[model samples]
Target chain A: MAKQFKSLHPTKFYRDYLNHDIRPDGRLISKFRPVIINIGSIATADGSALVRIGKTTVICGIKAELCPPKSERPNEGFLICNVDLPPLCSSKFRPGPPSDLAQITTRFLADLILNSACIDLKDLCIVKEKLVWCLYADIICLDHDGCIIDACLLVLLTALKTVRLPGVEYDAAIDKKTINEDEQKSLSIYNTPVSTTYAMFEDKVITDPTAEEEEISSGLLTIVVKNKELCSIHKPGGSPLSEEKLYDCISETINHADLLITLINTAVAEQND
Target chain B: MEGKQRSNVKFVFLKCGVVSQAKGSAYFEVDNTKLIVSVYDPREIPKKTDYSSKGELFCIFKYAPFSCPNRRAHQPDADEKQHSAIVKRALESAVCRHEFPNFQVDVYILVLENDGSALSGAITAAGIALAQAGIPMYDTITAATLAIQGTTKLLDPTLEEETLCTVATHKSDTEIDYDSHGIIVLAMLSTHEQISEFYQLGNLDLETLNESVNILMNAAKDIVPLVEKCLVDYVTKTLKSNAES
Candidate 1:
């Protein structure tokens, strides 16, 4: 049933459904597909989270290592986020360097997580300038259905929150840092940022567009909200949104942001228990 | 390491079609080492190519950063690149390349954990994945690793055992022994009883190397039943679904 509809002139089929305020998947315009989260599945990583938003699946693994602090930010730790879109995820991507879409998503995530100060870098500092923890977060897309950025942000936040850095024994004079594998401390998470993306087809707006819908939509808007405050708004190279449409999208984002935060917290709590 | 009571081989668990997105995939787990291999259907080679009758195989081997004791890089390191090439070579002989000329089959292997004998596991997993994808092959390929320490040879060595076997020994003026210690990895096509690829990491005498190959061939043969069962189960499931439809 689903396959047959997908092959039928997808754009026109989607537009026809939008005319009646219905999605091909039968979800209301404001409703999102069901989400399932699996946390701490990868025992090798310090922190890991695998999330499936509808059919789009993402896995995030966080590794912590000791590194010399940067000259400019001697007292703070480092955070690096990389997004990999390999051919295994979808046929559309090839096996090589990060594609343009992957690069954009990586930078956007860096902006959302680092610039927004979701985690305090100073908290990651082991010993002032002598030694610091460098957290590398690698987000991989296993299956590409749609709304990859939204799934990636969710998994990254969840993975970062779950990170537990092992204690360390250091001698400054000898410049030796010994990691204590037994005792561990969790990273200090300042806030949780949730992103909601929408696709605009003509004047109609759809939330959490699938791969098919995204291809037909004319404009795209992503809103990031943390603790009831706006963090960032991304709308690059699509149809310009009028003031009213933009306001509506922002309000809709706010409504869904709260839902997403609760969903994430519940998932994290379940994993901890 | 002489009096150690470690088993030559550990129990392995194999399953096929684990990765839902890939055309064909398999997950192989032996002790602490775990690998997931995915195979994509044949597709046209992107760049213009000269006339060639045989199809191409593209293989990528990667280790997740957390898979090893030390964090690995996102990009494939030199060792990983070499392993990728080795895997491609191991499987190329088994696959019937003339079936899909001017096309390439992609095989991607991701090592989720590394205990020891990862290459053998990857080679074995790739073969099963290709078969699960319905790719015609002359025979199934299986691989095994052997670590030699002096006169003692260990089969399916663990990371620790492998390290012990590869350590540099002190040389004495009175007596010197060359090609006595090293690790050997051999891939074999079981039905044909042919050696597809062999990799050695250290020195080994000709006699000892022959003995190790014999041991590795037996171990590789032992794994054939497990792969056969997995592929048979996959085919049964597919046929059952087709019948119902």
Candidate 2:
């Protein structure tokens, strides 16, 4: 591991900033950076979206393939989400195997997708037990400035909205194969889930924490919510927080979700138009 | 490429190439692993202290964080540097470096997703990039790695399979079968049917090494034509546009 220099002491500075009701970036604690969402950037994938939250940038590509469903859930389709943090994004990431942080983030995003009630798995099933459409949602962090979770979620949701699955064709003669590009159908989703991450330092909650801020923070909280319901809450931190504070973080995330979803919808609407 | 599992792993080239900025670019996917490569010409070399008669080629290989099941670190590491050197060597062998004296061409490869065989993917990408940049090359180079697990030889093993095989082979006290021992990565120039570079990890015997070379040469033979076709198509398109202009 490379030696790293500590930035400002977030625990002490955050407390001062909170007392003054000012964040390090000169915004209120509840504020977020200016976000821009673009859909259908990758023409090769079934659906794709590019999102930029402040300086953090992410690209999400969703590809749907046919595969055998798991034995327990033979009637439903499968959703797999993977996040890639290339070295170009940051100097800290190595090129080969994934580190612990990458694994945790991938799992967290997968949980968010699974719990969101967004895509109807039954519709993805080609046959009862034999074949199902497996949607692979691959998220690439092109540039990591901060607020990765929120930017990643925005990309995933926008990509999902723009995705159109090729129609599935079934042939009785052969053991069952989903039709090729010419014969496929798009998937219908119920709700879109947006995620917001907050870093709490020195009794102050900072929204869209930057890379430097994340390094010095006491604890980090990621909240994934859909339609006012909490889908996933991932808190990987050393410092403990009071239940009341956690509740405040969740509420703040929910409020952020409302704006994120609107932004996603508008981006999709513009793409369609 | 030389081993029992060589046949199981296959490389396929898809035509009607994508990626517009590259002078010559092609998309090749080895089974589940996919990569796109674009080559830029020998532009004016960066003004620096040293200017060798042999031209320089700048290479950059990137794996999208989600390329593997686990998220990739947000930075480059030693492995990337090592692979970059390997790619440079593989291309240097086939390219006529003296032709572009005082000039440098750049090869940029991006791995969209990686199931296995990322190094080989980069080698193939660099070859395409070189051709795209209109640099004269004797032939295209194709590279592949072969790993042995016990009596079973695995071609292009995934990260999981690689770990399992490495542990299983190194732990046992049984007689070391050089044929099924260690990992061998080979790069071959298809037209000449010659080995450009060979790297081995762990212990291996001469016979196994020979067999591995043969296997990789065969794989290179299969890949060369596809790359040629892509290059021809690209050149034809460029000539047509030039005539029209």
Candidate 3:
């Protein structure tokens, strides 16, 4: 009987559960799924991470290259982020170029890296106006269930935290740089930010919705928190919510930030060990 | 890295149906190199410029940005495009194209790590994925690579070994850099006993090339049993699940 109703009137079915203060997946209104992380799986990459939350999985690989610095920001470096949602991951994605959702998430991730002070750009400079490290962080979705941004954000953070740059020496007289591939150095991370996605189902706002729930939901609200403080909020377009409901989402994300940080730390530490 | 294993293929790990969305998918890992091959169902040809009696096959080969020693761009480069063509040619003869006329099947290979012989790995994985997709095929396909230097033939060489065998080292006085060394990749249908594709790099005498081709054929044939075992396992698992449900 339940399965028949679920397939017939999916929205009405979800509404029935919401009225009973329950979710189809049995998660509470503010409950979040557990995160599983594996670091440095790609041996060729400077850094790599595979993160899974429920059925959604995302892998991030960071490639570091040397390039000439911009004239205006000579000491600053670059963190170019891109997201690929191939047809292998989900049927919604096509085989052509990056879709709008991918482009939007890529830009949103780049913005979070810059605004959250995750890493200082000056640390990547080898010489003033000469050479700087450009990190190409590519995030690929291997599985698409729902709430992909949260998994991608954690993957980006974990991959960046595990990056190790090689020893580099610049010669002013020769105008060339020599890199010692063996002598490795690690990056200094400033702050680690965590993200959580919540969906507005009619009047009820549920956190960490599955792909099915997201389909029935009206809109999505992503909350990014670092050190128990709000770092960024990405609410592209959604139903209007009063101040109290919005604060509820932020507070839930902030409470979960510590758990995410610990997960990342343990995963990275395992690789070192 | 020594003994009889040195001249034979390296240790490999393979899994099927890794990508849930694709009709068929396989992941192949040889030591440090890892790749994923996905095949989609036959669909209408994108442009459809002309009428044809047979179906079309499209292959795309890509190396992840962090997969190689050098940082790769997002777009496909010249080498990757060539590899894409090579892979398509390797799998062309095995498929029964007349079954799905005018439609097109797409195969995508992404190398997560390019330790060595990435092209050969892609070809082998592509064949397995195609079979898993239930595409009509005449026979099972397998591919192997051999690196030749003088009289030495190394099967499935590593990246360092491949470069050393292919790239010509500059001499102090000699003008000719072409040496008796090169790398060869061969794809063959195991049951049909026919070679589908052959790709060679560097310079080698006809005698050496002939000798290496024979060696690669045997190496490629040896892989047939393992691929069959994998496919058998897949069928057994599916049967078991279906029976339970």
Candidate 4:
């Protein structure tokens, strides 16, 4: 009943807006909602950032802990990204193991951050095969307004930038690692990757689609770009796009990536100040 | 210990209807501790039962992975379950369960940051959210936590203050014996002037316990006005929008 009602009213309403080259929220076909970010708000975590894309709010907190590196990749550290869409964020979610959307977003984000090589895991190693930093990036969505992937990616990367690890002194004799809080160093950022999500309904496209827009759109395109390089493109296969249209999406991502990078830099600078 | 008066500090910054999707929602902050609660619409109970007259109140209390000093697991742990049970108990009686028999009103709370008194904060936020959701309630419920240290009681204690309560184990150690510490969390229906639920941790004598309860009740009362204002603001906004529409 709810699905039928959604399709009947909101879907048609969205298509009507797209017919005129505008979105339901009154944005241009390639326009995005304002992005706001606050870094280092979570004091308990080593690094943290809270980001909002339109009404979607996500808080990403990174905790750095020392552990033994994997035997095969003894020199590399570990990075894990978990996206939590708790019931508090929306009525659709429940209290239990993560839903499919949560898991998929988590995996997609983990893959994006890793494949993009935003942070070199090798730099996190303290002692070869002995001690390394395990960075856990947990992103919790407070509101599920729409375009969660973009919000999650933005917050996670911003949180990563704010991460600082204290100096660790390894005692081989006892094999005990002593952390020096006075000496701290920020993680080396290899690349800054920003993602943009577009919702295509029939032949028209809406940028940074809101929750309502996403539900009715026939296809979804999420593109991750880093330093003018295409890092990743994810589509779950709803509606097929022509090669030219796909290129248009990629170019749109490139355009938005520059703005996102500047937004992140401003947020980080404001945090340091 | 820091020469700060308990009553001087205005704790528990609160705002209601923060989550747009939830039927009703609230966000609360006290010091670094922050909690967000959303009350979803009543839905049919998934499990079949043999003729139940009253509806159910489902509560889930989650601590975000980075909410505390330690990294919490992705899944809800034993402590979270315990808090959920307490919250469910505190709210079940206050809600008019007969309104929606065979259904459940889901209250989900997430602690974004935890410095201390998270359970009490959750209870308070959940109550306000439920009220804003238009659920029928006997009265608005509010909760307050007090950490008893010796003869002094600290209201709205932080995580450190909550643990400052060290129980005296030996009688011969008079200094430590006098230092008997514990925590009392009370959820009350201020209009009815009755406590819906109470949770105590550690040990306390009857006299000290009574004194602590009084302090907690007063603290809970102080938060009532703030909750009322939030609800009033929500009602006014909703009424104006309804009128315009």
Best by TM-score: 4
Worst 10 residues of 4 chain B by lDDT: B2-11
lDDT (tens digit, per residue) of candidate 3 on A33-56: 878998999988899999999878
Please give the distance, in angstroms, between residue A184's alpha carbon in candidate 1 and its true position after superposition.
1.0
Task: Extract clashing residue pairs from model 3.
Answer: none
What are the candidates' individual DockQ scores? Answer: 0.42, 0.05, 0.53, 0.85
Per-residue lDDT value at B144 in model 3: 90
Candidate 4: the clashing residue pairs are B115-B159
Poorest 10 consecutive residues by lDDT, candidate 3 chain B: B1-10
Best candidate, DockQ: 4
The TM-score-based order of candidates, best leading, equals: 4, 3, 1, 2
Native-to-model Cα distance after best TM-score fit, residue A234 in candidate 4, in Å: 0.1
TM-score winner, 1 or 3? 3
Off by over 4 Å in 2: A1-19, A176-184, B1-60, B63-245
Report the lDDT tens digits of candidate 2 across residue range A129-154.
88788888888776677777778777
lDDT of 3 at A19: 92
| Model 1 chain A: ten consecutive residues of lowest lDDT | A1-10
* lDDT for residue A70 in candidate 2, whole number 0-100: 91
Candidate 1 at A132: error in angstroms? 1.8
Q: Which has the higher DockQ value, candidate number 1 or candidate number 2?
A: 1
lDDT by residue for model 2 (B1-245), tens: 32246444464654423543345556667666777665666677756677789888777677654466554554666776677777777788889989989887766666766766778867876777666766899887777767765455677766555665555343346754433466667888876777887877766666766776676666656766776787788779979989996
**Model 4 lDDT tens row, B109-172:** 9888899989999999999999999999999999988877666677888888876764544445
